[model samples]
Target: MPSSPLLPSRPSLLDDLAHAALARACSAFRQSGSESFALPPVLVDATLGNGHDAAFLLSCAPPEALLLGTDIQPRAVHAATERLAAARQERPDCRVQIFCRGHQELPQIWAELPPEERQRPLLAGVFNLGWLPGGDKSCLTRAESTLAALDFLLERLMPQGCLSVHCYTGNAGGPEEEQAVLRRAAALPPRRWRVAYCRDANREDSGGRAESLVLMERLPISRREMRVAGLCQA
Candidate 1:
């Protein structure tokens, strides 16, 4: 008999879980209806390495949704640009914006967006942490910057919006970075955010150094309510 479509044919990997989280977020957003927003909602790929995540997000995001991507390396930006060119052509209604910048600068970049775009709800974001594959290993994400970026995104994420972070703990400083991310996620108020950490427990490779995936979703509550409850800033 053929494998059931509902069940996975193979064990789920970190990427599989991350994409599943994103897909769920997209589905929720669609159910919420686009009429809630004055403009289409936005999705972000914080680490647009090779554009694979960006492509996946674009495929799942609602029609005309704006997809923003960023990378510190010019080569990565170029590669993603090329990789996404066909998708852009195929979906002309959807807007694609690529930036050659670090994730740490996300706040400043967001501040510079037009008022209308800034007002659009942030539906989802993806962050694949650590060094870029097939690139210089010396240039990798750090805890300080990554935390700063997460702070900004969490503050702005729309209620019911989700963010997926895949942290590879096998790289230099990776263990420290993963711990910092987990601490931050755990610190979020339960009334306002839902956070989950997934990893392979039985894996013995790399002396128990396994890739970790953190999934976070903002609960359905008004910003005003959160502020009134002292859970968020005014």
Candidate 2:
């Protein structure tokens, strides 16, 4: 008998730089410490894009956790809703809510949350910055709105919660948005937030530019307070 050819090896999740960020973000959520809330923790996808990130996060979320996604375009919302609905059919226990709104509207959503909902611990927030994939390229995320939404997310993140942002450098306004986010993340009080940026050194776009993923994790209140006091005394 003739020898059978071996099947091609499956691609690693980290093979794609963008997917690597999603993997890291999910890992952070998995490794997070327990929260005191009665309800399952919440995860927010600030940009729904093609719904890939939102769906991936939903698939990994705790059974009762709520996955919230937002997009400025009606089409994006509809697409994400469809994708999530399909996901729910397989994972019937998952809960997902999507909104047709800009990322900056996150603060409004926070305000609208009921007392009980507001009390739920926020586990993770994800941002895929730039224009929505396969959509109008001109409708790029603005630095101002992205910064505002990021600030709101950091404020609500639970102790040990994580925020991950994947910024593409090739699109219009992409560099500005990336710089603004980086500056804000860097300015976050180091005692309260741990910030890390990862870049694929070997990869470059057509313009020889590179993308980056920024991850910020909130520290415990006691630890933050101790560092603050130490700084004051010093």
Candidate 3:
């Protein structure tokens, strides 16, 4: 008899887990009652690799929302632009901004947005930290720039807004980048930030290729809630 297949040979569990994380981030915006906006909510797809994440993000975004996609490689930028264009043909209302800039330039681009746009709620920021699929494998995200970009983006997150990242630790230097991101997530204050991290249990100790997802939400802190926490501490 043939040996039983492991885990029933279902779809990619890690990918499913990451997708759920992104969905939760999108739902947070809906629950926060932040939908009243003069302009549609803004979203950032920081590393637009092959545009899969960007497409998913556009699906979850509010109508006419602005989606910014960034990548350092010309090929990636071109491919993502094409994918997003097809996505736009399907949903013609939404607007997209494609940039060949480094992901680290995200903060700068966001900073230059019109004051009114900045005032609007940011629904979500998604990142896939690795090289472009089917392209150069050596050009991976670095810890320093990735951490800096995360910090900059998180500081601007509207209440209930979240940042989600899929970190692929299968390639050279990828594990260290993921670890740095985890350290940053660990350091966020619980009172103001809610973070969720998920990794495949089967790959935890195998020292093999693995992917992890991290979601960080900036909590809406109220005066009453702060006082209650202070009283409890006292």
Candidate 4:
């Protein structure tokens, strides 16, 4: 009998379990707002980049929910701004605020908006960490800065609103930053917040051999909260 070329020399049970757990976690959350809202809450794409996450979040929020996308790269800000502006045709009331600064500057940017818009409830924030596509590698999110941004998010996000961090391990500092953030996530007091992780089990995706999506929420004693916490490796 000819040996199969791809067969593993040993069992990979632990890897299989970890992968399945992560897959289940990503599927836990249902998409918000089936249609739209009259005055939606606020959203932040802390990494901005191409504004894909920001655009999607805006669409899912209430019709009037405003959005602010910030990135350290000027090109990213421009790209996100342009993308969001174009996406707004379908969501006119969805105001967009683009900032050319580090994600840590979110609080300052949020404060600078008009009183009425700034006062809107923040639904959830998104962070796609890594270099701006085709941009300088040095400008990607840092560990210290990311933690600081999460602190800001926790303070500003409305109850039950979440913060999603898409961590990339295949790039500079991405693995280290993900580790630092996860360590911080582990210590988050149960009374104040919950941590979640989603990873594909099969490593079948073309993106990479593995990837992880992290979502953090502030909620006390809820079914969702418990489920999220249970998914955390920390």
Candidate 5:
């Protein structure tokens, strides 16, 4: 995968893990077969900073996939849009949507999608939470907005689909946002969702605060649970 010029020369460890998770999710979704799942899997970059992650997703996603991205900063959006131009040209079959809006607005955006596009199974969603790298530090993602977006995505994530949240605890409001994310991850019912929280205990790279990654996968409901929920015949 090509690195975006807007990003630093060295990729962060959190980024490496998030990218790996996304790649595995995409690969797994492809191997799951269309007969058992929806065609053209849908993936989202919830925090599209410079289009680096979006580009990476485009490379790994199924040939006929929908890639949605959102960013709160116009400059970030512009940079990402520019960064993805080559990839989009290379992969004409992949549909890409880049929104210059906050992740919190995802519900409204999702509501506006065509019924067919809306019906496509969301296979994965990745969030790099904090502020845009090399952008305004004052404009940061808040816990309320992040949680709202997470709630919406979690409800729609397909079975075996995963959500990768990379939280940076270095900036203003970052700790609060990370704490909120941890709380939500902890609250998910284990029967329906598998969640993991990882952090470096010995390293404090970002202003003496360690970064964390929260990975959550949606588990398929058993037939008994489906019957209990009235989703299947008794």
Candidate 6:
């Protein structure tokens, strides 16, 4: 006999027995081996606010892998550390490095790593600019450092990896910085980078309609060719 493509793959139950019962069982298996595949790449959370992003990064990779979280404010760093410490309760097996410096100095951090390690792929780099939530309002991410970090990311970001930018444009100097970043994003060529801009899902971001989330991916091709393709795509 021949099999029918439309037939069910699993056996069907015939008797209801005048009652219905359903149960689902989930079993989690423990994994002991270290990630043997080149440390599973690196991830950079440029503004590690509350450490949520850092914690998530650590969760995705094994403990020996490299994960970096950076911020310029001392308080912000403290908050991230505290948050990460809490996350350790759930994910005690992961490792992460935190930096308390502006993004403009990332090149120095990259230089400090071993030569062979520097060539490893970058998984993802994210930026949440503007002031820290419920923290200091006087301080914020500047355009200079943000752009510098973006340049570094664009150069070294892993293939198919994404960089997400969240910007707040209502505060002082925020609009100008947003404008500069938009111009820079607009200039990216299709051959080297693919971009998608979306509205933040939080309701708090609704009233202003000024906040934006920008995601960019580095393509496999060169910038010149990408730029030309972008012209044609338009």
TM-score of each: 0.87, 0.79, 0.82, 0.71, 0.87, 0.70
- Candidate 6, residue 188: the lDDT equals 83
Q: Model 3 over residues 131-229: C-alpha lDDT tens digits?
A: 887899888788888988888788767656778877878866778888999999989999888888988666642354788888888786654653353
In the range 148-220, model 1's lDDT, one tens digit per residue, is 8888888888777899889877888888888999999999999889999988686543653588899999888
Error of 3 at 193 (Å): 1.9
The C-alpha local distance difference test score for the whole of candidate 5 amounts to 0.84
User: Can you write out model 6's per-residue Cα lDDT over 108-224, one digit (the tens) per residue?
Assistant: 988888886576556577777888878988888888889999888877764456677777767777666776777787788877678766544553532444766666766554435
Task: Point out the worst 10-residue segment of candidate 4 by lDDT.
Answer: 21-30
lDDT of each candidate versus the true structure: 0.84, 0.74, 0.75, 0.66, 0.84, 0.64
Off by over 4 Å in 5: 1-9, 204-208, 220-234
* Pairs that collide, model 3: none
Error of 2 at 94 (Å): 3.3
Model 5: how far residue 230 lies from native, Å: 14
How many clashing pairs in candidate 3? 0
**Model 4 pairs in collision:** 22-199, 37-63, 40-64, 40-65
Which prediction has more favorable TM-score, 1 or 3?
1
User: Which candidate has the top score in lDDT?
Assistant: 5
Cα distance off (Å), candidate 1, residue 193 = 1.5
Q: Would you list the rank order by lDDT, best first?
A: 5, 1, 3, 2, 4, 6
Clashing pairs for model 5 are none
Q: Which stretches of candidate 6 lie over 4 Å from their true place?
A: 1-39, 62-64, 89-93, 200-209, 220-234
Task: Estimate the overall C-alpha local distance difference test score of candidate 3.
Answer: 0.75
lDDT of 5 at 98: 91
